[model samples]
Target: MGKRYTVPARQGLAVRLKKGEQVRVINTHGTQVVDSWAFNAADPTEFMSMEHMRQGINGIIPKPGDGLMTNKRRPILTFLEDTSPGIHDTIIAACDIWRYRNLGVEGYHDSCTDNLRMALVAIGFPVAEVPSPFNLFMNIPVRPDHSIGWEPTVSKPGDSVTFRAEMDLVYAVSACPQDIVPINGAGLAPVDAHLEVLAEA
Candidate 1:
């Protein structure tokens, strides 16, 4: 049987999967965003690279069957299905303390970078190995003027996206805690998310 985990709002979790294992991420309450990062289990230095994915997939927004590449240009994960509106964005970097400071926020705030680092570190990754994440369920759309704009997620309860592991990997996910931004359900609150792994038949 596959394992299941619940990532609390503003927290993070780590999942290790063998090659060919499938993972499904569910937005339990709809409108919550999950920032996720993937790493090659054999070599942590060679992690997921958004630049490579952009170049390889060559799409403003990735589609089903698009392979998410690593820093070494190897396919790490293949997007299998999306039950939502299929509007997740891959262009933005995960949130961090510096970003909060830039926005005039005073103290330490929950950010994806911190969350991913904490989660991965607990799973044995070094503190210096943080990488950019693939923002799942995030709604950033390119405008007609060629600029991007943020919008609330359209994912409803039970909406989900599943991915097939192309290679053995350790994945990290953070339920974003940007309570001051509209990205988290109209800036109201972050909600819990569900994750589960499935073995290949």
Candidate 2:
């Protein structure tokens, strides 16, 4: 048995992942992106790290079955499955001061942090307390020479991924607003994400 919930873009949604329940995120529309972050229910600040996540998962880039590890080396969530063949921009990171300056944009008028802040406010969390997030369905590939290139989205319409919470956890997600790069192609688009809680196995 599973409980299903749907979250639309620019909206905030919260769900408690009881130990052992599996959660799946479905990209209902193709090319839509989602950035996510997780915390221990007991202590929200102990967040997940992309570096640690990659290392803990054996230096492998996250994919289906990859586990996202917390700063304390605890398993926060496990990537149980993914339907999208590939996602976009993992290592390129969210937009910020450096990005805006480098892109020759006026300044950081809009960014992933801004979107995350909005989502937190909607969910009743103080905007200042929002944690760093995991970029789901984002692909940044490293070239053979060790350089990285922001690539186009590997996900197509209707792609999805499934994860299992290793502990009681709280998570936040946002459809990225990074139109300054190839990740979003030319503009920001809405992504539809659906969550389902699986019955105890």
Candidate 3:
């Protein structure tokens, strides 16, 4: 049986996955964003590089069967299944202190970068080398004019995306806490999400 756990609002988690094992992230109430990052278990320095992965795939958004690559351009994980419409974003950086401050809000608001750093440490990764995350269930649409659209989530409750670890890996996730925008459901308050480590079928 696979191990399942819930990540509360504005919180984070660190988990390990062996090669061939699959991990699924579920939007419990359709009101949360899961920011996920991965590292090579043998050498943390060679982590997933969104830039290389995207360029290798020749697309900004990855689809099922796409193999995500590392800075060294090696495949690390594969998108095995996506129950949602695959409307995720790789262009946007995870939220941080400087961003909130620029929005005229100050004083240490909760952020994805902070959550990722905290979560990754549990798996022995240094905070300084944290990479930009792969956002799941985030609806960032491109208009005909090439401008971005901030549409609310189109994923229904229980929607999920599962990934197969191409190598032994350490992964971290943060339930995004951006209440100022309607990105996370209503965005007024964050909610919990489900993370599961499923055995090979």
Candidate 4:
């Protein structure tokens, strides 16, 4: 078993993954939405891109065995396994303070975008513009009316999704702090998540 790392509630964490290695992210409470991103270790600018991934996968939600495409139009991580309902999102932008402001939050609100920035800085990586993350376990289903609904995750406790590193890269996760919305759950409470990096078999 690999050492497990805690992604604190309302915060972010980042780790390095070498090519061929795999990392599994766990929804410890089954209620948190983890916004996730991967960046090339050699070039942070070449990070995961949801737009490209949608084009590559021919869908919005990537399934197991899909290669997550990067902005450079290459695979960054390969979706390996999903023990959840596979209700992840690729269309929403990482939540930011501006988003909270619009929701009538007067003060600084913990946001996934800020969490991503801080997490990268903690790992000594240059902070860059927030990319559209592969929102693990997040549920934003498109309706027949061509609109979307922010629904709670359908994953159960201890559910996880695993990905294999396509190249040496930095992976980040934010146990999203979207308290104003019910996306995390009906409770609207964000909680901790976990991850483990596995060595190549």
Per-structure clash totals for the candidates = 0, 9, 0, 0
The models' CA-based lDDT, in order, is 0.86, 0.67, 0.85, 0.94
- Ranked candidates (TM-score, high to low): 4, 1, 3, 2
Q: Regarding TM-score, does 1 or 4 come out ahead?
A: 4
lDDT of 1 at 55: 93
Question: For model 4, how does the per-residue alpha-carbon lDDT over 60-157 read when each residue is reduced to its tens digit?
Answer: 99999999999989999999999998999999999998999999999899999999999999999966578889999999989999999999999999
- In candidate 1 the C-alpha lDDT for residue 13 amounts to 91
Least lDDT summed over 10 consecutive residues: which range in candidate 4?
A: 125-134
Local error of candidate 1 at 121, Å? 1.4
Give candidate 1 regions above 4 Å deviation: none
Residue lDDT tens for model 3, 167-193: 998878899888887788664678889
As a TM-score, model 4 comes out at 0.98
lDDT of 4 at 91: 93
Candidate 1 Cα lDDT to native: 0.86
Full-model lDDT, candidate 2: 0.67
| Cα error of candidate 1 at position 196, Å | 0.5
Q: Output the better candidate (1/2) by TM-score.
A: 1
Cα deviation of 130, candidate 2, in Å: 5.3
The 10-residue segment of model 3 with minimum total lDDT is 121-130
